[model samples]
Target: MFKAIATAAFASALLLGASTANAMIINGNFEDTATLDPTGLVNGNKLSNLATTGSSWDVFTQINGWTTASGAGIEVQTNRTLRSVDAHSGQHYIELDSHPRPNSNSSMEQEVALDAGKYELSFWFSPRNDDASSNGIEYSISDDLVSGFITGPSVSPLTSVGAWTLVKALFVVETAGNYTLAFAATGKQNTLGGFIDTVNITAVPIPAAGLLLPAGVALLGFASRRRKRA
Candidate 1:
């Protein structure tokens, strides 16, 4: 009986340790709490804290487990709506000037780090209108802001001028550390605009010993009683 109890306790401890270890925030809210802001924000937009250099935007904050940011130049009123349960956000429309000669490229960007592993990154975004050929946004990721960068899970070309769209991308972190995430406005240069929201990066949870130990001990005792009867 004692051996069974001990075994159960040990198993429980292992499971608990695993759960506590795995459930962590690679990067929680973008308060710029860390002095490393690889992804700069738009000036005048709301920001939680200044990125690295103590420079902050005026368009982002943690409102009920969500971060919001927007970048709209002098043209038509535009903004980006972003929210995340873990640590992700998005936006809506950002109208840039005409294309080619008068192209208006208004955008916002962020940087985060992760351990080398398989991750599923997803976000909800939309352009001024659902016109992939004419209006949309482009996103890219790089190991370093200077070099060694990989493309996105899938660069979504704006096609539907709907209310909001959900886009997903899968990527592996070859090296753990900081990486730059860039969001750009793509398509015709005239009156360019868009929005992004609810971005999240989630990894599989490890098992928790606390949850397992009790079960193991109970099983062990049942086995021992049966053995004595036999």
Candidate 2:
């Protein structure tokens, strides 16, 4: 009886732990920015302000809590006029391809400390223009593996230039530590690649039903022991 009771308690605790996990990402919305100069440059990276600067800016050098993992970093677009594509949320979004010239290859990364568990990574992405095609964005956890990729629509403007599609990936960490989440652009490069916004990371829930297995095994062992003694 005591063994059965203890098993029940253990199962309850496991269920509780799974339900209480929280998000670990910071500045996931990409809404915050450092002050831009008169030339629309932030920390040497030119931010898109609807004016043709005839130069491209780096994204890693500007955004807080993020860094350029590869290529020339990324570009931040804020000009509503120049942007036929709208942001998924807030007033700004990030272009994976840096400007001056469109880059086919670019990457960005952020460092986050997380507890060991399953996590769901999600973000909203869209093409820069109707002509953008074959461009792909790949996501990785801890920079160790390429978890998944989102490619541009086979047909240009599948929905609209700015219409966003939510991309999601699930990953598990066996040990708790600081991990680097990275996004890289792949495939053919164009001025219009992919835009990212509203990135999020949250712990995946462990079903309460899974806890029953161990509890059932414990109870069965307890019952068998008692019957054997009789």
Candidate 3:
């Protein structure tokens, strides 16, 4: 009887560990208080922190949960900007391209460690301009930066403006370690780019675990029945 109880408890614990979805992205919604400008204004925009060094656009060295991965820094946007809309969930979002005055596109990356399994990454993307040449963002989950940001989870010549779109990508991990999850601007290197927000990553339940889920349930039921009889 004691052995049976121990086995059942162990199985239950494993099930919980395997099935729960964990949110990996920190400060994902960009709502966490960012380093604010002293006068609540930047480059004629509402109020936000400056990027690494660009004086023509809005960028940041760090946010609530992420840091600047490449090319100056992370571009941030608020609904208070000229000809802009509200963020997907929070008060701020991201722009892949920064500095309209002839600068290369930029990227931001976050690294996450995980066990061998499947995971899902999702975020909200919106175009800031109506011109097709202005909106393009490429996203990837890999250890190294994607080759020139050539990827599918990307927007090229994205013309739809001010409309928020949900983008979800699945990642299959063969070994447990740190993985780089990144987003970069593609197409023209113009200042205009895709707006990103509500970034989130979650682990997918293992198929093998699913096969054992029924067994875990049955064992739990059997354990309950035995307890009642005792």
Candidate 4:
């Protein structure tokens, strides 16, 4: 009976200690100012704003220019941010004559360097167009250069475009160090109306073996104290 109780107590102590490990934020707030940003986007990542129709996607001169909007839904809370770009309605993007509609032919992405470990990544999504289209968002993670279609999470393809919605996915890192993350939204050429917002990634805390050793010693001390009292 003593052995069983001690084992249970030690296990509980270990669990408690492990849960206390600090989960470091490797990449946050899409603050990386880089050249050729969107071209390096991950499989799923983006941010945008909404205020009725006819407005195009916002683009900040620099990532430092990003800020949160007021009275937005929870999905738009963190992972995604606002921008004023060429997003538009009526099968046309960017009021400029050269840009096409539906913004489907276009994609947006950003990059960040992150430490390795388990992580919970989530973001808000909303279609800029109410038209019948298969517009959807996707996220990708990579250790090498942010190129090609890196695998991660994605909103269901063939979606009901238009209106706002939140999407999230979890990923684990096998090794530690610098990596590239991207988000892309694509559709038929000249389709128009696509937007993304509030991209966020949080590291999942991993239990450390070293943390358990002290707890084990504490458990042994408690057991010894109980014996003396008895």
The CA lDDT of each predicted structure is 0.36, 0.56, 0.56, 0.33
Residue by residue across 3-87, what tens digits does model 4's lDDT show?
1223433454455342323233222333333421321112222323222232322332223323212111112112122332221
lDDT of 3 by residue, 1-230 (tens): 21122444355446545435556776778766544342222254323433223232466666656766776567776654534456777556787677644665778878777777656566666766765556677777785312222212234312245555555444566778887777888757777676778877777575654543331011111111011121
In order of TM-score, best first, we have: 2, 3, 1, 4
Q: Which residue pairs collide in model 2, if any?
A: 46-57, 56-99, 59-74, 104-189
Residue pairs with colliding backbones in model 3 are 51-59
lDDT of 4: 0.33
Q: Model 4, 40: alpha-carbon shift in Å?
A: 20
C-alpha-based local distance difference test score of model 3: 0.56
lDDT of 2 by residue, 1-230 (tens): 11222334244445535434335776677655544333333345344433234433334444666677776666666434243555567656777766444543678888889787666566777765645454567777864522666655544213235456655555666778998888887756654577777787767566756432221111100110011121
For each candidate in turn, give its C-alpha RMSD to the true structure in angstroms.
17.6, 16.4, 14.8, 17.6
In Å, residue 136's CA in model 4 sits off its true spot by: 2.5
What is the Å distance of residue 230 in model 2 from its true position? Answer: 85
Candidate 2 differs from the real structure by a C-alpha RMSD in angstroms, to one decimal, of 16.4
